[model samples]
Target: MSQKPSKSTAPEAENAAATRGTRLFLGLSCFLAGAAMMIIEICAYRLLAPFFGNSVYTWTALIGVILIAFSAGGYLGGHLADRKMALDLLGWLLSGSAVLTFFIPALHTVFAAGLSAQGLIAGPVIISLLLFAVPGILLGAVSPAAVRFYSLTLKDTHVGAAAGTISMLGSLGSFVGTFLSGFFLLSTFGVRSIFFGTAALLLVLAVAAFLLAKNTLRQQAPVILSGLFAFFMSWMTAPKPKPGVIFEHESFYHHIEVSERTDGDVTRRVLQLDSTMEGGMDAKTGDLILPYQQYWKLALLREPAKVGSALFIGAGAFGMPENVSREFPEAAVDVVEIDPQVIEVGRKFFKLDEHPRVKAHAGDARRYLLQSGGKKWDMIFGDAYNGIRQIPPHLATQEFYQQIADHLEPKGVFIMNIIAAITGPKAELTSGMLATVRKVFPHVEVFAVGYRRDETQNVILMASREDLKPLIQDRYVQQGSWQESLIKTHVPKGTVPHASYVFTDDHNPVDAIIARGLLE
Candidate 1:
C-alpha cells in the first residue's frame, strides 16, 4: 500500500535496532557500576556502625569523604581519557574496581579490629583511610571515564544527550541500591554479604569490558593481572567469625550483636540488640526486668478491659512483647521490626520463641502498616527510635500520624516517647511534635515520666480522641510505677513559657531542633 517500502530501508531499520540495543547494554553496565559503588559506600557504614554509633555525623563524614575521593578520581580519569582514549582503559578500571570490592571485607576487618585491638582507634582510622583511598579513587573515576569513552564515539550534540542519559541511569541505580540493600540484603544477608554481592556485580562488568575491548583496544594485561593478584591476596586474609558465635555485624541501621548465653543451669543463649542496650532477656527464664519493666508499664496504662490487641512497632529484643504477653494473656500482640536478624537473635537468645501469643513481622513499620489492610489497633506504640535523633523522619511526619490514627480504634490511645531538654521557647522540638499530633488529634497530653525539673527529661505523650486525664493521674507517674521510680527528683521549672510549634513533613527540622537542644 505504501508504494512498496524500499528494500534498503529494512537493513537501515535493523542497523538502528542494533545500535539502540548496544547503547542500552552500555547504559545498563554503567547503571550496575553506579549501583555497586553506592552499595559499597552504604555497606561500609554498616561495617563501622557496631564500633561507631550510627550517628548523623558518621554518615555525613562517610559520604563527604567518598565524594571528595570521587571528585579527584573523576578529574584524573578525564585527564587520562583526553590524553589517550581507549576502551582498554575502561576494562582496566573496571578490573581494578572488582579487585577492590573483593578485598573490601578483609580490608575492613583488618582496619576495624586489627589496629583497634592494640587500643588505638586513631591507628585503625589511618589504616582504613589508606585501604579505602585507592578503591574509592578508582570507583569515582568510572563515571568520567565512561562519559569520555562514550562521548568520543558520539557526534557533537549526541555527546550531551548520551552523558545526560548515562548520569540519569547512574542516579536510578543509586535509588535501587539504597532500597535493595536496606530492605533486603542488610536485613537478611548481613553487611559482609552486601560487599560480596556488589563486588560480584563489578566483576561481571569487568569481564564484559575485557571481552569487548580485546583486539579492538590496546593490551591491558598488566592492570588486569595486578587486580587479580590483589584479589587473591585479600581473599586469603578474609576474616571469619568464630564458631559458636551466634551473631556479629556492624551496620548503620543498628549495632548488631548476639551471643549464646549459658549461666548456671540455663543452657539457652541471650541476644544483645545494640550497644545502647535497649533489648535483652534471659534465654531460659524469659524474665524481663528493670529498664524493660519500665516499658511494660505502658501496657498496664492501657484500659485493662479494653486492651484486646496491640501493635509494638520496634520489638528490638521482643522484651516488650514478652511482657505484654505475660500481662495480657488474651491480647493479640503484633511486632513489626525492620531487621529479621534481630528477631532471630531474639529467638535464639532473648526468649522470643517462648511467647506464643505474639506474632512477629519482619519489615519496615510503614510497609507493615500499609499491608495490614484496615486492621484496627487498641494501642499503637511509637518507640521505634532512640533518643539520638528524636524520631525517624518518616515516623515523625503528619502523614505517618494519620496512618497511626487510622489504625486506632474509636477509643484507642497512641503513646509515644520523646526526649526533650527545655521547658521554655527552647522546647520547640517538643512543641513541633505536639503540633504535628494536634493536626490530627484534638488533645495531646504529655506526662513527664522522669523529673520534670531536670533540663533533660523523658516525657510520654499520649494522644487520643478521648480524655486521658484519669489514666495519666491514676496509672502514670503519680501511681509510682517502676518507670516513675527512676526519675531524678530535681526537675527544672523553666522561667520562660513553652512555645507551640508544629512538625509536619513540610516544616519539621528535627536535626536543627536536636542541634539547638544540644547547644542549650
Candidate 2:
C-alpha cells in the first residue's frame, strides 16, 4: 500500500476554504467593476445627447477620457496595491466609483448645458472629463488592485495564472455588459435609472469586498448603509420636468419632450429633441407654429396637377400631414416617424387626429422608401432632422436622394428642410446638399425661410423632374397675403454654387460640416 495519506487538519482545511472564498470575492468584484465601467461609458452618450447631440465629437471625447482615466488608474492602482494587500482597497475603489456614478445624473444637465454653451467641441470633452473621468479612474483601479489581491490569496505562486484569470473574468463581464446594456438596459430603462442600477451594483460589490476582507458586518454597516442612503436620495431628488414640460421621455433615438411656452399673446406646445425645437403647434388651436411647416406649402403652391399620394419623412405635431389630408382630400398621406413614442405624443398631447387618408408608420424613413417597391408618391416631404448639427448620415447621402427621386412621379416634387447659413463662409452645408441633390434631380429650387442670409436657420430645398421656373417667378413677383409675401421675398433670384465634392453613402461628413459651420 502507498504510504498512509494523512488527512488535513481542521485549521489547515479552514484556511484553504478561506483562501478560496477570498479569491472568489475579489474576482467577483473585478467582474462587476468591469461591467459597471462599460455600462457607464455607454450610457454617458445618452446623458450628453440631450444637450450636445450624439456626435462624433461626443464619442471621441468619451472614449478618450475613459481610456486616459483607465491608464492613470492602472498606474495608480498598481502602486496602491503594492503598498497594501487588504481586500478593502478594491472595496473602497468601487465604493468611490459608486458615489461618483450617483452624482452623474444630477450633474449632467448642469455640466452639459453650461459647457455646451461655451464651445461645442470643448464642451463634450470637458463634460466627459468632469462627469466620467473620476468614476472611470476609480473603477479602473479595480483590475490591478484585484489582481494583486488575488495573487496574494493564491496557494500556488502562479502569478500569471492569477492575473490572467482575473483579467479573463473582467473581460467576460465586459462582454456581458456590452451585450446587456446595448440590447436591453438602454431600451428597457431610462438613463438615470441605468445610472442608479449601476451604482447599486457597484456598492454591493464594495460591501462584498469588505466582507471578504474578514471584516465583521457591524464594522462595514455604517459605510454600506450610507451608500444605500446616497443612492436612494439621488433617486428621490432627481430633477422634475420644467414648468411646461407636459411630456418627457427618453426614446431609443432621442431625449424627447413636449413643452408649452407662452409669450404675452402667443402660446405654443413645442416638440424638442435634444437641443433642437423640431416643430411646434399653437397651444389652444393646435395649428402649426414652425415657419418651415408653412414654407413647405411651396409644394402645394406648385401644386402637382393631381397629388394622389404623399410621403412625409418626419411628421411632428405640426399637423402638416393632417393639413395635407384635408387640403388634398384625394391624397393618401403616409407619415414615417422614426420614434414611435413621438407618434404617441402627437396623438396624446398635440391633438393628432385620425383620418382615413392620413396614416402613420413608426420606422426609418430610408427603409420605407427602399421597401416601397417602386410605389410612387406625388409629393415627398423631407423634414427628418435628427440632431442639432447631425442629420442621419444615411439620409444625407447621394444614394438616398436617388431613392427619393426614383420614388416620385414624373411631376412629383421633393421638399427638404435644411438648417444652414445661406451666404457666407459657413454656407458649405447648403452647397454640399445642393451638389448632392443635383446629382439625382435635374432641377432644384431653394427658398430662404430665415430672413438673415448669413444667420444659420431654416432653408427649404425643393426638387422635381420638371423645372418650376415660371411658377417660382410668378410666386416671387406677386404678393398679397403673408404667405405669398413670404414666397415673393425669400426666394433667391440666383442659385447657390454647388460644392465640388459630393456626398456618397460610402463617404459623407454632413454632421461634421454642419457642426463646423455652426461653430465657425
Candidate 3:
C-alpha cells in the first residue's frame, strides 16, 4: 500500500470516481427537472387566469391534461432509456423544455386570445393543452431517464433501491418547488420574470448535463443557440396593452386594469378584474355609472333609522361605499376588500380617500366579520364576486349568510348584488342565493335593477330579521323619490322556481350552475 499503485489499479480507481460523479450529476438533474414541472403547472393557472378566468373548470382542464401528458412521457422515456441510456438525449430534452418554457408568456397571450372566441368550455381546454403539454412531457421524461442512468452506475442487485431513491428525490424537489413558487417567487417577481428565471435555470442544467457527459463543444452548440433564439423571440413578442389603458397591475388574486374611454362629452373610467368590468364611474362628476349601484340605495331605504354604521363586503372602485358615505354623511362606512391592490387603485383613481368617515380594510369579508370582536352593523352589503358573472363560492354559501346575519343589528338589513336573469335557466344562482338567505332571515325580497326580463341583470336581494314591507313604505312616503319608483317598477312578483337547492361549504356547485345558466 505504501508503494505506488499499479497502472491497471489506477485506471479502475479513476473509473470508479468518474462513475460516482456521474451518479451525483444525474440525481441533481432529476431533482431540478421535477421542480421545473411543478413550477410550470402552478404558473399556468396565473397565466391563463386573465383570459379564461381562475375557475374550477380551467383548473380541471389544466391538471387533467398535464397529468395525461406526464403519463405518456414517462412510458416513452422508460422505453427509450431501456434501449440506450444516452446522456446527450437527456441534455436535448432539458434544452428543448427550456426553450418552450421561455416562449410561455408570448404563447399564452396568442393562444388564449384566439381560443377564447370559441367559448369557455373549448377555449380553456385547448389553451391549457397548447401551452403546457410539451413542457410537461419533456420534464416528465427526465425522471425516467435519470433512473435508468443511475441504475447503470450501481450493481444489478441495488438497481431497485437506486430507482426508489431517484423517485423520492424527484418528489422532494416537486414539494419544494410548489412552496417556493407560491410563497416566494410569485410574490417577489412578475409572471414574465418567473418564466424567464425558470428558463435560465433549465439552461444551466442543460449545460451541466452536457459537460458531465463529456460532450464536445460542437455537440452543445445547437442547444445553446436554440435557447438564445427562443429567448429573443419571446422578448420581442411580449404582450402589450391596447389604446386607452391608464393603469394595469397583476396581483396574487387578480389581473386588474383601469381604462378610460370617451363617449360624447362623458369620459367613463372603468375598473376591470380578469375579463369583466367590476365597476365604472363618470370622470367628470364622480358618479357611479353602473346601473346596479342605483339599487344599493334599497338598503338605505329599508333601514333609514339604522344607517349610522354600514359595512361593505366587496369594495370595487369604492363606488357603493362612496355613494353611501355621501348619501348618509353621518354614517361610519367600513369596507372590507380582499385584494390590497384593488384598495390602492380605489383610493388613487376612484376617490375613495375623499370620504373622511369611510375606512377600507384589506381581508376576506367573512373572516373579518367573524373576528371583528362583536362589532355589529346596521347594514351589511355583499358585493363580493370573482367577476360580473361569478360570485365567489364561499360568499354564496349558507354558512356565509349566517355570519352576515350575526354581524348585523337586530333590525339590520343585508343587501347582496347578484347577476341572474329573472326567469328561464339563468335563474338558478338567484334562486339558490335566495333560498340560502331565507334560511337565515325571516324576510327576503328580490329587486331587479334593470327592467329587462330576457337579459341577465343585476338582481338585488334585501334580507332582514324583521318585516321589510313597513320599512319600504316608510322610506317611500318620506322621500317620494325616483329610487322608490325604480324599485316598484322592476321588482319581480313571482317566486323563484329552483329555491329547493341551498349551497353549503361542502356542496357548492355554483360554477356548474353558472355554466348551465350561460349555456341555456
lDDT of model 2, residue 413: 91
Which candidate should be chosen as best, given TM-score against the real structure? 3
C-alpha lDDT of all candidate models, in order: 0.66, 0.81, 0.81
lDDT of 3 by residue, 1-520 (tens): 4998687998899999999998888888888888888888887887887777667877888898889888988987788788877787788778989999999888886778877664556677898788889888888888888888888888555888788988988998898889888887776777788888899899889988898878988989988998888888888888888688999887777778999999887789999888878888887767888877776676656534337888999887788888888878999999999989899999888888788889999999878987897899888888887653357788888899999999888878898888887676778878888888898998988877766765577788899988876655444453567566555744544656657788999999988877677666
**Residue-wise C-alpha lDDT for candidate 2, range 160-253, written one tens digit per residue:** 9988998999888888787888878887899999999899889888888887777888888876777777677677767678888988888777
Q: Model 3, which residues run further than 4 Å from truth?
A: 8-13, 117-119, 263-266, 283-285, 303-306, 471-480
Q: Please list all clashing residue pairs in model 3, or write none if there are none.
A: none
Q: How far is candidate 2 from the true structure (C-alpha RMSD, Å)?
A: 2.8
**Tens-digit per-residue lDDT, 1-520, candidate 1:** 5698899999989877855654665677778877776777777776665444344544665676677777888887788777766666766677787778777777766676554332223332454465556777777677777777666546444788778877888778888887877666775776666776676667667766766555432354565565667667766876665544577754436756665546576544434444344455566666653242354354355455446788988875677677777877898989988777666666666766778888988888887999999999888777676553335677777888899999999888787766674375446666677778878887566655554423655566668887654554444364455535533221232322354665666876676665456555
Which of the two candidates, 1 or 3, achieves a greater TM-score against the reference? 3
Candidate 2 lDDT (Cα, 0 to 1): 0.81
Q: In what order do the candidates fall by lDDT, top score first?
A: 3, 2, 1
